[model samples]
Structure formats: C-alpha cells, structure tokens
Target: MNDFFSTTILIATVASGIRLATPFLLASLGEALGQRSGVLNLGVDGVMLMGAFVAYFVVLKTGNPLIGAAAGILLGMVFGLVYAFITVNLHAEQGVSGIGIYLFGLGMSDLLFQKLVGTPLPIMPFPEIHIPLLADIPIIGPMLFTHSLIVYVAFLLVPAFTLLLNSTTYGMNIRAVGENPAAVDSLGVSVTKVRYSAIIIGNGLAGLAGAALAIELGIFQHNLTNSMGFIAIALVYFGAWRPFGVMAGSLIFGMVAAIVLQGKTLGIIPRSASDLAAMAPAVITIFALVLVANRFKQPAALSKPYERGR
Candidate 1:
C-alpha cells in the first residue's frame, strides 16, 4: 500500500486515467450533440464495435493509422445515415430502431471478423506526442502533456463543443429543436435536417472513439469495447448534456479505472477481489447517472419523432 503512494505510481496512474478517458470523451461528446438535436442513439456501442474492427483491419493491411481512423469515421457516418433515415425520416421509435442498429452492428462486425480473419493478430497503435514545454514540467508534464494525439483531441473537443452549443446559430437550432421542435419548425427551421446532421456527426465521433480504442490498444478482439459505448450514453446524462460536464464525468470514470488497475498491479487489490475491483467504474457510472437524472432534466423532445404537423 505504501508503494502505491509513491510518486512514480501516482504519476503513471494519472496519465493512464487521462488516456483511458479518450474514447469515453469522444463518444459522449457525440451523443451530447445528438441528444441536443432531439435524437437518441442507443446503438453507439454497435457503431463503436464496427469502427474498432474496420480500423483494426485497415491498419493491419495498410500500416497507416490515419487511414484506418478515417475508415472508422466513414463507417460510423454510414451507420448514422441509416439511423437517421429510420428515426428522422420514417418516424420509427428511436429506442427500438437504435436497438436494431446495435444488434446489426454487433452481429455483423463479429461475423466479418470470423470469416475474414480467423486468428487475432496484433497491430501498431498510435504513437505518443510529447508537448514541447509542457512535457518538461514537473509531475504535471508526464501526467497530462505526453500522450497519443487522440487524447489531446478528446480534451480539446470539450471547449470546441461548448462554443458550438452555446454561441453558434446551428447550435441554437439544435437546442431549440430538442426543446421544442414545433417552435423551431414554426421559425422555418427544419427539424429533420437538424436531427439528421446531429445524428451523423454523433455516430462519426462514436466511430472515432472505437478507432482510438483499437489503435491505442494495438489489438482487436470480439466485443473489443466491452460495452464502453453504453457507458458513453450514460455519460451523456451524467454531464447534463453539457460538454464540460461530460469531460468531468469521463475523467472521473477514467481515473477510477486507472486507480483500480494501479492497485491491482501494486498488490493493493487482492486477486480474489479483482473482479469486484473491476466493477468500480461501472458502479460509479450508475451512481453518477442517478444523481444527474435527479438534478438535471433531459430535453423535452428526446426520443420523440418530430413531424412538421400532426
């Protein structure tokens, strides 16, 4: 236990926490955008699985992480389009359609993997970038400034999304649509267009999250995400649909995960209770969700299909 408190272990734990937060940050940000436009996509996990496999396979073949990441984003957008068509155009029940998409993504990704690559093979992950001056700072440097490019991108997005949702015209339209589609429609805004745009972008981010995960880990497996996507959805609520709030939630979950992992490695956590220790993050998520649900109200139009008129 004393060894666990040493500076080296502490710094490593913090850094790992930040790294682990990347996918959660990316996925939750995307979900926040979709929710703000009155669309709920519960299939984020499925989209993530599809993205993870595509990114892995692409990198395996091309040896380029960039191309693999792009392919993942594109595949996610394709799924987003289908989801938009079902929920936005066809007026299907958002929850049911989302579940269908999830099932499809889950089954299809595994099927493709089994048929195409019978054995799991390792791939190169994204390389880390150390910020010049920042990386040299005491303690804080290694804990925050040295990491894969995706980690920085994930954090930067918090402020970018905050600006987009609070200051931009399109952002206003999204918020309005989520709150009152009828009002936005009366003002000549097309709710369908807004919702569609939000969904595609959201799903694309979800894909990127998956790609980041696979690339960060340098390997792929069946159910690589292990339901991380669903946790991202929960994070949307945990953040009260706010970008910065989402970042906080992601960090909390990430840090908890890091702590658990560190404790296990240091023997502070016994092997017998390792499974229970692994459950800490999920338990925290559920607790956070409950608190947020009670304190913050979701968008009024969430999960409801909007038609211009009755």
Candidate 2:
C-alpha cells in the first residue's frame, strides 16, 4: 500500500490507464451514436473481433498501422451496412439479429485466422506520438500526452461527438429520430436513413476500436475483444447515454484495470487469483450501473424498429 503511494508508480499507473481506455472510449462513443439514433447494436463485440482480425492481418502484411486502422474501419462499415439493413430496413428483431451478428463475427474471425495464419505471429503496433512540450510536464503530462495516434484521436472524438449530438443539424436529426421517429418522419426526415447512417458510424468506430486494440497489443487470437464490446455497451448506459459520461466510464474501467494489473505485478494480489483480480473492473462497472440504472433515460425509441408507414 505504501509503495503504491509513490509518485512515479502512481503516474505510471495513470498513464497506463489512459492507454487502456482508448478501445473502450472509441467503442462506447460509437454505440452512443447508434443509441442516440434509436438503434441498439449489441453486436459491437463481434464487430470489434472482426475489426481486430482485419487490422491485424493488414498490419501483418503491410507493416503500416495507418493502413491497418483504415482496413478495420472499412471492414466494420461494410458489416454495419448489413446490420443496418436487417434492423432498420427489413425490421428484423434487433436483439436477435445482433446476437446472430455476434456469433457470426466470433466464428468467422476465428475461422479466417486459422485458415490464413495457423500459427500466431507478432506484428508492429501503432507508434507513440508525443506532444513536444506537454509530454515533459509533471504527472499530468505523461498521463495525458505521450500516446499513440489512435489514443489522441479517441479522446478528441469525445468533444467532436458531443458537439455533433448537441449542436449539429445531423445531430438533431438523430436525436429526433431516436426520441420520436414519427415526428421526424412527419417533418420529412427519413427515419431509416438516419438510423442506417448511425449504425454505420457506430460499427465503423467499433471496428476502429478493435483495430486499435490489436495494434496496441501487437497480437491477436480468438475472442481478442474478450467481451470488451459488451463492456462498451454497458458504458453507454453507465454514461447515461452522454459522450462525456461515456468517456468517464471508460476511464474508470481503464484505471481500475490498470490498478488490478499493477496489483498482480506488485504481488499485492496472489498470482493464483490474477484471473479473479481481472474481473474487478467489469464487476465495478456493473455495480456502478446498477446504482444509477433508474436515474438516467435512454433514447425513447431504442431497440424498436421504425417504419414510416407503421
């Protein structure tokens, strides 16, 4: 406990926490976008898995992180189109469709990996980009500055997304569609179009999130996301469906996870219990959500298919 109080160790832990939070922040922001447009995509996990594999394969072949990230986003956007088609256009059961997507991604990613690269191989990840003067500042510097391009991009997106939801025309359309599709439809806005766009954006972000995760880790395997996608969905609720809230939720999870890992390393937690220790962040998130479950409201039409005629 005393050792944990040291300034250097604390800063390192916080820096690591920020790094760990990137994937969650990206995925949660994407989901928040979809939910705001009245779409609930529970298959974000599957999307992430697919994105991770795609990014990994791209980086393995090209040795370029930028191309890998783009590939992930592209692959995810294509799948997002399928998800939007089923739920938004065809009016399939959103929940069931999402589960099917999840299963498909899970199986397909593993299958492709096995067939393409039977043995796991190492790959280059994103290179860290440090802000010149800011990185040299005291504790806050490293925790906030020195990080990969995706990390900065992920955090920057919070404000950009918040502005999009709160101040932009498209943002208003999304909120209007989510809260009252009939009203939006009556006003000449296409409900399906808005929802489709939202879904694509969400899935694209999820893909980027997966790609970032795989690139940062420099490796991939079955279930690489390890249910982090579900955790991102929970973050939407935990954030009360707001971008800043979602960011906060992600940071909390990241910090807790970093702490847990630090504990294992410091021998504060027995090696035998490391697995259980890892559950701490998710458990904490669940408990936090439970406490505030009734306090926040989600988009009114979330999970309900919208048909202009019906």
Report every candidate's CA lDDT.
0.92, 0.92
Error of 2 at 284 (Å): 1.2
Best prediction by TM-score: 1
Lowest lDDT sum, 10 consecutive residues, model 2, at 1-10
- For candidate 2, write residues 147-259 as lDDT tens digits: 99999999999999999999999999999999999999999988888998999999999999999999999999999999999999999999988899999999999999999
Residues 41-146 of candidate 1: C-alpha lDDT, one tens digit per residue: 9999999999999999999999988899999999999999999999999999988888888888888889888987779888889999999999999999989998
Q: Report the CA-based lDDT of candidate 2 relative to the real structure.
A: 0.92
Q: Candidate 2 regions off by >4 Å?
A: 270-276
- Candidate 1: pairs in clash: none
